[model samples]
Target: MKITIWPAGILAIIFFISTSCKQNAPHEDAAEPAFVAHPVAVPKQDVMTLEIGKAAPDFRLPDVNGKFVSLSDFDEAKVLVIIFHCNHCPTAQAYEDRMIDFTNEYKEKGVDLVAIMPNSAMGLLPEECGYTDLNDSFEEMKIRYEYKKYNFPYLYDGDNQSIAIAYGPVATPHAFVFDKERKLQYSGRIDGVEKPGGANAEDLRAAVDALLAGKPVETPVNKVFGCTTKWAWKSEYGKKVEEKWNAQPSTISRLDEDGIMALVKNPTEKLRLINIWATWCAPCVMEYPELVALQRWYGHRNFEFVSLSADNPEHQDRALAFLEKTHSPVQNFIYAGTDKYKLIEAVDPKWDGALPYTLLVEPGGKVVYSSQGPVDLLELKRAIVEHPLMGRYY
Candidate 1:
């Protein structure tokens, strides 16, 4: 007899058979049924956005090299995967390796993977960028693209975000897969795992494999969880964060040689970032704002940024004024001693007594990172986040 098993009917029969077999079987402790039917919860998709089987939207966005890349460019590929990702999101950063591996593995099979940065810098707050060294600006996109050595075309849609709007990506690292006819076959995350070094891009790979074999995707859509996409309209909210930061009172205190030594000792449990700069130092003044931004970024964690000015004790007013102008809300101090050598020795014995000296000290006063010249903010941020105490993700 030819039997046609409907989904519900099959589930009921499996349940009945398993129950009956368990009750009558000689081995009462026999293992449960090899296969059990569990209802799959489908993730909700935006009603107005691209639906399953809908044609992929056309987009002409600039790549890292300033060349415009469009959907039609991948027409020859049997499968196309477009990932809406950004530079700042930790989740996106974690999946970078997987995306690269997926691209390299599938390229030989007529598959193309393209990444589009779809965040507006205006909508991203400094605190939101706490987990990353780079923000979602187009220029930063180029930096990330080159630094990460992405195997796929990395495009920028941050200017207007019109392309992002059409795709309706709810989060960074959201993936959309299209077949040869440009019909969307899958739309969700690259995998079920959120943290780095977990599952490979199994969900995405499954969709691609099915489409390549001229078969429908078994699971076309799944829930995507990551940093929310920074839409341009959210700039108003970003302004509020800036206003609150600026409203905080900027104050500077006098730090003698003893005080500087104590600060360097770092008795507290937090990671202390000590920056020794002077108001007269041009590079110090130029990079002060970024230092303030770094404080704001990692301030919530077990981290503190302390600024020690090497300006003359008599120039306290000038130093304080500069701090106020830069909206520095961190612990600010100016050396109160006439001898600059004492200040230098107190901060670090191995110091060359260079202006704009920066160092990261652990709780027990172990210096993890030290820079003598103008600090590279990106390098500093990486050192901070990658430390044992702080991580890219929880």
Candidate 2:
């Protein structure tokens, strides 16, 4: 929803109108909505191995085309190449173009390259999503496939992830090659290069060449390097990272009506951004990292970003620790009164008591921007840079 700043806000309507002129561009709205993935628990995939001389696992899985594909799908192919991959990993993205090129080049030599997304969508974390344009969700995989126009078969194994566990891929872009008779010939990385530009697919190329020549692969198993498969246990890892972050010293002070009103009034000369969030708000937590990043980006530009937690007084320390974990480098507050309504109305009547509410106030206490829930980061960036108060600094 487009927010209308209160009349008391400086140049309220005019500010929106004028800023809209410079801020609203056709392409800005073209950005895809950010996908927030939830976490779920399941028995973690135990260590498993496909012995070097053992037959490659044969199973049927749905391809991007909605058709079921299996190991036997590649007919008359002298070699089958199964690559455990996903859309989110930087390592996987870095190798996408290279993977496509390799498949095209090798297809002429009877080599079939089939890609599979190995992580459950529920297991994907937003913190792990910043590095890529897409997540590991099935919908995201389809979007990515259409966007990249990948020539090889891209399948989904995230439902049960049985194939992934069977092959035991440590990371995305982990390659598993099978000879004409479907024997596991090579298992490891697609290349020696991680960053991609100047590096060649040396390791994988050698393995494939040797097998095609009817010889043993010189390196049967090369170590793989990439983002760990987003197993269910990764959710616990996120909690641990948050715990480590919160372990640092942090301060969370009580915020009374007078103090809250004072903060909202923007007594200081800097543009003040007041954000109301809660420890239990999933959307808020998902957005915390980006909020911290914004502060780092615009802190020197005379912008002050303050956070107010609606968490109960008894849990103030928890809120403070969360702020610290998020690397919050600004004023932090906790609702002080027993009456939550007083604090809510005092903060912003238009807020309707939302968990994650943000308002950017001009130096004179006039709000220029207000939003609730998770914000489209693109517009958030534009709002900060194009505001009259911040334009000069930009």
Candidate 3:
């Protein structure tokens, strides 16, 4: 035969190559593995503010009484107004009376107004609350609603913020007006003036008036000027604030009797909150952090929180370490003298040489609050926030 006996190894290699080629070849009717699709990641789209003529976004939110209220509840009104307001914004506080008056005036005319607190408390840092006595929490919303005796509905959208994301308010005091059909006709500042006592609700009034008259609004949009809307995503900034505050140098100075007296005198125009604490005192160590928190809550306003350590001058390093551990960035001092009575007298005459004494001193040494034991933080907060110089509103 022309084909001699082939070597077994060569024949085996040729057979393997032919079988591998057949196995690798595609099948014509194998169903192509059922066209499996792996899920792909898509970026989230940003929610934009409502545009003029758009249908009002539906929402069911809780009012002060824990009763659920919805947009459809006001269907009988010929005109509707929604104010994205909060407890903490000075601009929103400035317009509270005006909003109340507007609600009263328009309710008889078949127009209804509702104030929606569209802020997430998680996004509100204590430092961002300098302008008011309360933060934008549902509980605080209830407090404000009751305090103001608001005629209109005051709903809270802070839990999930889905309603806020839908409305997309850029700032507190932002206003939206809707016609009888529940179509948005205007969105923006409540009026031209930022401060109170001008042409009250001029812009909002015009939009409501136009809609009630069955006419198109002349200015459908205006630039909003107020506290930036506290979106839930903004909570990330709280970490940065904490980091920045912790990075500050935690130094303690030696304050003699005179220096301590000077601190009590409060030369500056700020409301001074002074705490006298000893590193060895259990109550002092426990309550120190809350005092620091108070500093953050009202620091941006005309306020200062001074920490005067009852620790001896020689133990300043120990006191400084404690302050650093607590991330206290306020002015800190350690008593330079060994006399505890002088320290008590210098900080506050009313102090009975207690381990943890606190004082809220106004400028020129007027004592607004004094506590001997672990303070009731809420009471202390109220004292600080309700003071004349630190009032909630402008």
RMSD per prediction, one decimal? 23.5, 19.5, 13.6
Question: Comparing 1 and 3 by lDDT, which wins?
Answer: 1
Q: How many clashing pairs per prediction, in order?
A: 0, 0, 0
In candidate 3, list every pair of residues with a backbone clash.
Answer: none
Per-candidate local distance difference test: 0.86, 0.78, 0.85
Residue 143's lDDT within candidate 1 is: 93
Q: Which order, best to worst by lDDT?
A: 1, 3, 2
Q: After superposition, how far is residue 17 of candidate 1 from its true place, in Å?
A: 93
lDDT tens digits, residues 28-145, model 2? Answer: 5575544333334668657575768888877788777567788777757898888888887768888888888888899999999999888975567555654444567777778789
> TM-score of predicted model 2?
0.56
- True-vs-predicted CA distance for residue 209, candidate 2, Å: 1.6
Which is the better candidate, 1 or 2, if ranked by lDDT?
1
TM-score of 3: 0.81
Measured with C-alpha atoms, the lDDT of residue 277 in candidate 3 is 91
How high is each candidate's TM-score? 0.86, 0.56, 0.81
Deviating ranges (above 4 Å) for candidate 3:
1-45, 280-283, 312-318, 376-379, 382-394
